[model samples]
Target: MKFVNSLLGLSLLLAASSQAHALSRNAGQTNQSAQQESPDSPRPILLNYTLLKTIDLATLSQNLASFGIKARNGVSIYKVSYATESLDDTSLNASGIIIIPDTKAAVFPWVSIQHGTIIAKAEAPSVAPFEGLAEASQGFVAVAADYIGYGDSAALPHPYIIAKGYQKPLVDLLRAARELANQKDFDLGPLFLKGYSEGGYATLALQKALETDYSTEFSIVASAPSAGPYNVELTGVLNVEKPVVNPVNLPFVVLAYNYWLADGQLALNDIFLPAVATVEDALSGAYNSDQVFAILPSTASGLFQSAFVADFTSDQPTLPTSRDLRALLRTQTLLDGWIPKAPTRFYHCIDDNEIPVAVTEQAVATFKAAGAPSISSVLIPSPTTGQPYLHGNCPAIFSPLQWFGEILSGKAAQ
Candidate 1:
């Protein structure tokens, strides 16, 4: 027993020493590169996964100062990556925040966060609105994926409707977290999934894919998805008259179809005017959400007059006949016959002006009808008196945390 114990200790010591050496080498190389660059045109400070873990709040604040990522009291950030197999072409590159407890024992449960639509690095923080739940209440590690076209890789187009494009990043990110946990110093127990709006849809689709595709590698403890368009076709139909949903989401959906369908059958000329032709180039290369939204109104107006509308409307007969056919073609859908294999807690506000709450209700009913295990949906009542929360706010989305806590504590309905 003593010999075996000594051997294990030696192995741990070797691992720790190797990790420290690698960190030192990387830091030295970075410093050397910085020195070679001109003082006026210095290279951006890049934080790696391992170096980020070694930093405390104070050190993190100092490091982020250079990058303009303000490190507030409760906001904790870290960098990470994962190898994924779900992408159609190139490997997915994912990077984002990680909030976990200071102590080892406290780190067990994990939550993977997905952000909303067209949001890029500038608005990336929005992806972690309820970060407190992961860092404080749940004692879990919360990881947010920046998706393929955001933050680190800003040149690629955001794949809005292409499920595989998003799925690769999500799956790879979760795998990265698990890989991090397996390290000698890291410890992550079970994991739960959560997201809002487009993120919500991502969470559900990821959960479904994990169960059916990557079940051997990942086990989801629970999931909470809010205001996601689980059924893409239905969402496009409902949003045409609403305008808020269709126009805002059209570019992303069209981009996804263009990338995923592989035929290059979808064209900007079909939907947008010559003036808006450059819009796709701008959007595809955007590094922030503000840029995406800035181009929406003009882009939408141009699409209204295109032949693409007629073809799209003709393709999706279920969409309201009165709505423009082009908008319907750009709508979201679930690619027939996809379902989740885990218990999921669905939440939505009854008065949500953005994505309709009815969409959430429909998803819940669909999951239940399909005999999903331990599925529950909660409709948060409109603000009563003192409290008022808008769409995608934290407090309004508390039920998901509660459900996740229940699952972590082994109390979730099976």
Candidate 2:
């Protein structure tokens, strides 16, 4: 925890001298690609930026040493506000952290990391530094989007598992990063996407949109979307049928859908029991996940109305409200529609309880059935427990950063 604090503390130092030295506009040589910007394709994505802090090589290496990672270069952390859109296509300002590696390499690859479930707005990447710092030190220009419900859009409710909701902000952020690179006179190399849990779902959403809608504008080198509930219709909603380890997840999703999908007209009384229907107050970006968890019930039946639970769990749900909820869940599915063109790897712990390993297996099987080329899955066991790697253990045990190292080193094919 001290190391994490050291990272946050280092990010708060706002020395102007270090800031100037870190991103000296005239320091590095410009790339030919930077000079050949398309005339009509202006850099209008970036709205504004702030130099949060710069981490020196020694300090960066010390901070990452505990994770068995050695820093190769220093990095400049910037909190960037960019032009993006909400789920309804309304133009808005979204924010994210861009960690630029302080290397003389003229060009750097873009690695966008979508973070896992963070209930509080303060935990957003621009607020608290995480993997982006380590990724920057490893020579990648890492980007972490704060997403809609956090950062600049903190006033809005987070659109939890909605695919299009995650897609828009991330795509715009990448475009904004490109604009930043062009302005900084540096060239961006291949784009790599990685994320875990909710971020994993967001990564897949971004990848699908890039491949399906924006292929001509952006090309992905590879993507690792690990431990996500890709088939949300089945894997996500079925949490009600099982004893949940994480209680806040279901309520959060319900409230998100009510606000985004049903336009907040689904009526809380129709979804949750009277005792838990006021859950929106706890999930309003005010409490952390643990605090929210303590306030909610451990089982879906305990939280949701018994009749609503029965309708949801039934094979042929009769109620119109139940059917409407099912339709919304179906729309959130990332599994069936299209096959991925990039080298995609699905990583998960074999013993994960929060999100079952079967989610990945189901997705892989569906993709294989659809003739998805260059798709694979890796299920790992816990080094410490040796069994039940669990959802929290998956990221540490089968890390995407280590996987990216292999892909970059050519040890793992991309």
Candidate 3:
């Protein structure tokens, strides 16, 4: 525990700062008991699981290509509710989808998918219930957490980049998923985690947390976090000053971070110019992903004040507020200086225009240097020419392919 704390000192600092700021912002909005149940709260436990829907292999295969169904498999989607602490350490109810195989197979490892950023609550794994079915068709008990602010917990603000905030619900849902599988006579095995984009960040974040804090309670045989803004400082923070092909990323990151760290009280004026700052509500979950992007300007520089962009681009931020924002973004990073206890594989495309390939390449190098036992990185090549594609184009589409390929190769479960 001490070692985990030592490695995550900066992350813990961010959580602490969030709590302190939250107390000041939300004192009247929440109860004292709600804020008290946090890091010191009881260890997470499975509350219950409610079956939502079921799907067969024929139906699953119709949607996904390159997924081979070897057995007469069926999937049961369950709305898994569990107890977990909120970003500010308050006790809150959360939910996820537990997609378990209905096959009579003896046992198999768990494959959990952390989905990308979503606005509408229904798009979450629990409501959509079809997100991880392709993986479940392979006889793995697939689980996908709705994170904090989706599904049953939609009223609370989503802690977009908070790693620990999502990790707790994932851990608890796995327990509930396994229990539900047991009730249905499906055996279980080792665990594997995979996700792309924001989900990728979460997959890696949970892997690190499970390896350290929950080492005794859970384990992932392998993990693949592809093209996430894992290097939050560079990809998420500093790069906001540069001209970005996608303008929405900067405001989305800033808005979400302020919502969590500042108790939804942080002024948009501090981070954005009048154009972007004035439309803060639209940036929230009220609008869909595409709608939010359309609302913001097309260029990153257009989103912020000209002087702030000048300061950021010159690598000399004079504004005191930008430094604090930068620090908050830094806390969102994963796998840079941490050591892993399990064999891990990183997947990224060389031409990934969203998150830089350099981030993934450099992290793999640093993890090896930090003495991770077994670590490897794979490139998800283009579908036709077998070369890397742009960040969002290729890697976003290849997450499940990489996950299923690993399963076929017996990388995580043998």
Query: Scored by CA lDDT, what does every candidate get?
Result: 0.57, 0.78, 0.68
- Which candidate achieves the best TM-score against the true structure? 2
Please identify which of the two predictions, 1 or 3, would achieve the higher lDDT against the true structure.
Answer: 3
**2 or 3: which has the higher lDDT?**
2
Best by lDDT: 2
Q: TM-score, each model?
A: 0.71, 0.87, 0.81
Residue 178, candidate 3: how far off, in angstroms? 2.3
Residues 1-414, candidate 3, lDDT per residue (tens digit)?
A: 232223234223323443454456455542212112358776435566555555567755553433233434777666667777787778887888777777777787678888776765645666555557657777777888988888779887777777877787787777767766666666778788888778888888889888878888886777777777777877754366447646556666677787777666555676576554456666556776557677766666667776666655556566766766667777777855579777777788876767777788878888888898888888766667644477545534345445556665777441
Q: Which stretches of candidate 2 lie over 4 Å from their true place?
A: 1-43, 274-277, 384-388, 396-398
Local accuracy of candidate 1 as per-residue lDDT tens digits, 1-414: 232233234334433543565567576652111122357973322223532323345543453343233443232334454344335665444565555555556346778876667544343432322233233323567777767666555455556655666776777677656655555257777778887788888888788778878899888877888877777766654554453443447555655565655345554454554344555654554344445556555443444533444444454443332233344343445434666667777878776666777788888887678776677777777658754444645233445766776766678674
* C-alpha lDDT (0 to 100) for residue 4 of candidate 2: 34
Better of 1 and 2 by lDDT: 2
Enumerate clash totals for all models, in the order shown.
4, 0, 2
| C-alpha RMSD between model 1 and the true structure | 12.2
Q: After superposition, how far is residue 198 of candidate 2 from its true place, in Å?
A: 0.7
Could you tell me the lDDT of residue 320 within candidate 3?
60
